[model samples]
Target: MLRMLPFLIVLALWIWAFIDCLTTPEEEVRHLPKVVWVIIILLFGEVLLGPIAWLVAGKQRAVRGPRQTPWAAGDTGNGGYERPRGRQLAPDDDPEFLASLKKDNKQHEDMLKQWEADLRRREEELRGKDDPDAGRRG
Candidate 1:
């Protein structure tokens, strides 16, 4: 047991550093991938470089958006900013307004799906073009 003291000290140091890394907010935390973060921390020691990682790693939310202008175009009826239907619907609400929301949501979802599919297809094409015989078994 006495011979393991050095190893235990190393383990304690690692635990302390890792906790410091996690306690930090995600946004403030460095955006680099895990592998990169590991390399940086390991290459740099606690006395000299440990503070760098502690300084990073925290959530950084975007600034609040500007308030919407009531007079904005398309927001009101008769060429003014008009609230879209269903925004203030009662329990017994307008079917047409609900339909509009459903349509808009469906369109958005469809577009997102299409974009994801296109990305996958492009990636596959790139792999195939880069090494035409990459998958061949010899």
Candidate 2:
């Protein structure tokens, strides 16, 4: 039972990954070809290929319109953020607003990195706990 447990768990994970890959759109999956993804699903199995696909070849690039920054939302961390009282804001040269926008973007990037690191830590912990000889190699 103990020996078979790992195999069963791995098989389950492979099936789940394969299903997920099948559902993901070809356009959204990057790096590898769509056929390669299928082969990964079929050949390497989920436990290995899922993470590989995600890390090395995932998430198609997208073009987007102008971003909405905190500056655009009328929030600068400074004591007072001034929007044009009369007709309109000048097209450019708003230092305070631009600075705030840059700060917001940096913070968001930092948070995303932290989240990825946290998730990686959790996965490593789970894998470590599952190590077969951790209890006693003797």
Model 2 lDDT tens row, 20-41: 6677887787777766777776
lDDT of each: 0.63, 0.71
User: Compared to the true structure, candidate 1 yields what TM-score?
Assistant: 0.32
What is candidate 2's CA lDDT for residue 125?
Answer: 79
How much does each candidate deviate from the true structure in C-alpha RMSD? 16.1, 23.9
RMSD of 2: 23.9
Return the top candidate by lDDT. 2
Q: In candidate 1, residue 96 scores what lDDT? A: 67
Q: For residue 18, what is the lDDT in candidate 2?
A: 67
Top TM-score model: 2
Query: Which regions of candidate 2 fall more than 4 Å away from where they truly are?
Result: 46-56, 59-138
Worst 10 residues of 1 by lDDT: 51-60
List TM-scores for all candidates, in order.
Answer: 0.32, 0.36
Q: For model 2, give the 10-residue run with minimal summed lDDT.
A: 51-60
Give the residue spans of candidate 1 off by over 4 A: 1-77, 80-92, 135-138
